[model samples]
Target: MVVLSKQTTEQYAYIRHCNKTSAFSSTGIIPVVDLSKPEAKTLIVKACEEFGFFKVINHGVPMEAISKLESEAINFFSLPNNQKEKAGPPNPFGYGNKKIGENGDVGWVEYLLLKNNQDYNSMRLSVFGQTTDKFRNVLNDYICAVRKMGCEILELMAEGLNIEEKNVFSKLLMDKESDSLFRLNHYPPCPEMALDNKNGENLVGFGEHTDPQIISLLRSNNTSGLQICLKDRSWVSVPPDYNSFFINVGDSLQVMTNGRFRSVRHRVLANGFDSRLSMIYFGGPPLSEKIAPLPCLMKENEESLYKEFTWFEYKKSAYASRLADNRLGHFEIFSAS
Candidate 1:
């Protein structure tokens, strides 16, 4: 059995007082598409164009798989801090504890990150160990199921864009060599957040940021904390739906569509009493692939908004910067009329 770490109970809440003024609207809603229906394609396109995020119901992943993974994850996090430390000394993979600050800002979450490359044997051994063989097996099954679902979504997206090369993204992202990351994020309860609520401040579980990937699939426990920033800058709380998955558009898709579909900025709020856990699977291109605006998406005289950059180069730049930094600015192209 895994032991608990002394610091596990420590609360790491960080409130950004300035952002407390940002209007939070209870009426703003995310489009929910039933992927199993015939209108899924159209609904998906509209959601991407207007919200850059949406919820999916009837996603086809076995409910039993989700339950097993959630239970195993809780057990994994419960493991002693030292055992968890074996998963990392650095950031690319393994457990990450909350850092106090780089510039007086901090997140109130811990996560176990794993790469989904072809090197599963070694990676599994390193991350899960032999004792948790059953856990590792269930995780692999979930990955396969999720990746299959992701490919189907990509196909629908391509069809929605009316791209002639309908299989372009599927070939690039679903390939065996494509680089993907599976992160198990745990947000321990910060009971102190009750004080923030009383004082009109927000306790952040995760800071506001845009994902730098092609697509992200998130499955969260039934605890409300996730919020998305709308076009008008209002924050809308995403209610918990245990049966659905939250899908978000990423920076790559924004560039690919030539700004037609935006990458939404989102954050998670700290819960006052209940802890939260989420599994996020990021689908990205192979590092060698270059990303740029699709020629079909741009008008004849319209200039490319962003220059072409390889996934490897972009990932490196993103990792070097702060979570909230505008990593895409480095690739923006200027037009001279």
Candidate 2:
């Protein structure tokens, strides 16, 4: 839980007012992909190219699983600070508060970051007490379902791009050593902070950044604070829909497509009256997996925009930098024309 001191509150506030504009007011402006549709492949590719993001429906994840995990998470977060601290400082994974990363970024949020594997079980068991088994079961069910949906989306992307191997992207995620991660973020309401602060700022729930993975699937409660930056550099709020999952094109995907797809920059603002809870599944490749522009994606004489690097290399660099840093810049190839 975030303690609301005047200094800390002021520090977390971000100045902006134009985000209230409805960017998705027009039909088809915000890509809505129905996974059950026959043309989903083409639509997914279009969404990746244009927005680096899209909303998915008919994704097959059980509503009971989603709600159950959310309920468990709320119960865990509602615990006393001292008790919750037992989950602790997140030395890469576990419970974390205010501090977003080791690189000095902070937000008005607390979160639990877990690896998508058995290793998270120990830490999870340590926190939930008597309900540990129930919490673990709910989390596992949710992760399993969402992982399947993520693979399906990746396969569709490959098919749409005419890649011979439909599973080229999905295979990495399915690998035994895949380094995927899941995060549950709780942005509590700050009713004490004046919405119309003298500086004209709103509290920052999470700072601006791009996910450093192959893809990211996000689902949040109806409380709206999530915003994505447009190509024109304008910020627009994404209306909440608890039943649907929002997909984000990640840095790895952008590289794999040779820049044909973009990694969207996005952030969250703290709501004044409603607490917001969100779950994000980051689909990553194995640590040793090589990352570079796919040869199949390049034109006959087109140059690779980025130098090759392993997932471990990129992840290290990304974690070392601030939230807003252009992490891909370090690996980008420059021609001395």
User: What TM-score, computed on C-alpha atoms, does each candidate reach?
Assistant: 0.89, 0.95
- The per-model lDDT (C-alpha) reads 0.78, 0.88
Give the runs in model 2 whose Cα sits over 4 Å from its true position. Answer: 1-8, 19-23, 26-28, 194-200
Off by over 4 Å in 1: 1-28, 100-105, 118-129, 194-197
Task: Supply candidate 2's per-residue lDDT for 188.
Answer: 88
Cα RMSD (angstroms) for every candidate in the order listed:
3.3, 2.1
lDDT of 2 at 56: 98
User: What global local distance difference test value does model 1 have?
Assistant: 0.78
lDDT of 2 by residue, 1-337 (tens): 3333333376674746764434456454679999999999999999999899999999999999999999988988888777777888788788888898898899989898988876466565477777888888888999999999999999999999999999999999899899999999998887666554665567889999999999999999998998888898877788889999999999999999989999999999886678899999999999999999999889999999999999999999999999999999999999898
Clashes of each: 1, 0
Model 1: how far residue 317 lies from native, Å? 0.9
Question: Which structure among the candidates has the greatest lDDT?
Answer: 2
